[model samples]
Target chain A: MSEAIKDLLKKNHMSVTDSRLQILDMFYHAPGALAHADIEKKASDKIDRVTIYRTLQTFEEKGIIHTIPTADNSVKYALCKDQCAEGHHHDNHVHFVCDKCSKTICLDDVHVPEVKLPKGFQPHQSNMVVNGFCSDCRS
Target chain B: MSEAIKDLLKKNHMSVTDSRLQILDMFYHAPGALAHADIEKKASDKIDRVTIYRTLQTFEEKGIIHTIPTADNSVKYALCKDQCAEGHHHDNHVHFVCDKCSKTICLDDVHVPEVKLPKGFQPHQSNMVVNGFCSDCRS
Candidate 1:
């Protein structure tokens, strides 16, 4: 898993620093996308707060992760699939946030459908967030 | 237009005050969702900053407006149609954010496609945001 993280960072031309490695490790084991607080809690004193924030920003810009917006205005992030690169993100799929557990997950099986805009409205890409109860929460 | 604002506020069971009225008027005339900064700039010397923020939160809870989340982590809000009332919002349609002008407009005509999640996932509501160039920017 650590090797995979290093390779991904190298592929994206990012330096394989300790902070990036630790953050990647957290995402690797997470059941779904994680909020800033979640990441901080899991980091558990190994990393500082500001560094984690900067690392998240860098990862997002590099397409290593994608932001998931929640109803409460807090943001979460999930790993990007291989299809996502520096300048292109083909990870435009539906995201599901569990109301009970507050887990934000990427529903990879479901793709965002193309919407036909009215005249003069040109679209580049889209995002869809579905709020509901996940399997674990329901059970 | 101001009278319309007062009536809408009253219909939603909110106290029709000056702050609420001015904010509603801003949304009424907005070409698309206005960020907090956009609203502040347009509010001129009429509304204070904290009041505007509180008013936005109230309006969102009352279903007078819906938030549109952008990639930059800045949120924007647009007026809801009559279909949206206090405690209910039928504005589950695609939103278009112009890359050039940063205008976030509701594509009320394009409804969000229902995605049948894998077994155990139950969906309640969804929001779709599309990013691209707007008509004005394209021209």
Candidate 2:
């Protein structure tokens, strides 16, 4: 886990510090993605609150992790899985937030269907989030 | 239109006022929904910025509208088809945000499927947002 963080930091041109390692660990352990509050609770014993926030920002800048928006306007994040840039990623798949566990998981293979837009609008990045009860929670 | 807002307000026991009506109007005309920033842009000219904010807060509290989390952590509001409590709603369907025109549209018919959760977790409310170039913007 630590090695993964180090590699990510090095690749992203960020410092592979202990604080960042712990924060990255949270993402590593997370089956899907997580909210700031989730990271705070899970990683508080290792990383400080401010450091986690900074690490998230830094990781996002390096394209190591990408932000996934939810229904509450709270920013959640997941690992890039090697598809992100300093300013963007072509993450055009469905993002699932489990209502059962409150965990945000990226549905990489599931793509959101194309929508019709109005004129004079340029295409940019896109994101898709689906919220519902997970299979485990339902059972 | 005025009667609609009045009816919503009265049913919810909220005070009916112009600012509230205007803010509600934006949500009404909005095919998807509007962010606070979007609301301010359409409404600040007629209502006080603070008033708009307060009215939105009240509307959210009273179940008139609900918050949708976006990729940037920006809060988006949509009028609930059925009255929803702060954390409860019957319309837990898919929501799409067009990257080209920055529009949030309700995909009420597009329902999200179930997910599998880890243990010891409770599932509650959920929000789903799909961001992409709308059909018009693509053209």
Candidate 3:
């Protein structure tokens, strides 16, 4: 895991700093996406809140992570698939937020369908967020 | 426009207050979804910023309007189609945001596709946001 993390930073030309590695580690083990608060908790005082936010922004801009919107309008970050590049992100999968657990997971298997827009609306990218109960939360 | 605005407020059980009326009027004439800043500017200092935010929240709760997430992570609100009720919003249509103009328009003709999630993940509601250049901006 550590070696892979180092390689990711190298690939993105980002330094293998402690904060970056720690945050990346969190994503590596995370079952789904994570919000800023979630990362802060996982960090456990190791990193400040502002630094975490900046790290998240940097990761997002580099396509290392993508943001998912919650029902309450909060943003969450999920690791991108291998296909994501610096300027482009192929995170077309469904972002499933567990209603019970409030955990957001990226369903990589389910790709967002290609929708035909009316004339004159050229589509660059699309996102789909599904709210539901996850496996653990299911009764 | 005044009568239509009054009827909308009445239908939603919202009091016909000046701020509510002004905000509703803005939506009625807006070409696309209006961001908080956009609405505030149009309010022309007649409405306080806090009051505008509350009014927006109320309108969203009543399903009078639905929020759209932009690529830049800003939230914009657009008038819900007539199908939206107090507690339910039939905003199943695709939300197309023009990258050039930064304007978001609800494409009522294009409904969000039904996606099949992996087992153990039950879906309740979903939102699709498409980023692109609108017709006017394409030229």
TM-score of each: 0.92, 0.69, 0.93
Using DockQ, give the best candidate's number: 1
- lDDT of every predicted structure (CA atoms): 0.83, 0.70, 0.85
- What fraction of native interface contacts is shared by candidate 3? 0.74
Pairs of colliding residues, candidate 3: none
Q: How far is candidate 2 from the true structure (C-alpha RMSD, Å)?
A: 4.8
Give the Å shift of residue A93 in candidate 2: 2.5
Per-residue alpha-carbon lDDT of candidate 3 for residues A1-139, written as tens digits (9 for 90 to 100): 5998989889889888999999999999998888898889889547999999999999988999988755557878889886477867877787888888888888889998999988878888888888878988988
- Candidates 1 and 2 compared by lDDT, better number: 1
Q: How far out, in Å, is residue A20 in model 3?
A: 1.5
lDDT string for model 3 (B1-139, tens) is 5998899889877789999988988998999999889988888647999998999999988998988855556888998887477777777888888888877898988998999888787788888889888999996
Worst 10 residues of 1 chain A by lDDT: A81-90
TM-score of chain A for the candidates in order shown: 0.91, 0.86, 0.92
Error of 1 at B46 (Å): 3.3
Give the residue spans of candidate 2 off by over 4 A.
A44-46, A116-123, B1-4, B11-15, B25-33, B37-54, B57-63, B80-139
Docking class of 3: medium
- Over B62-137, each residue of candidate 1 has an lDDT whose tens digit, in order, gives 8888887665567888887753666777787788889998888888788888878889998888877888999999
Tens digits of per-residue lDDT for model 1 on A1-139?
A: 5998899889889889988999999998999998888888888557888998999998988888888766566888899866376766678778888999988888887898887889998788888888989999986
lDDT of 2 by residue, A29-90 (tens): 88888777888888656567787788788888777788877765677889987648787776
User: In TM-score terms, which candidate is top?
Assistant: 3
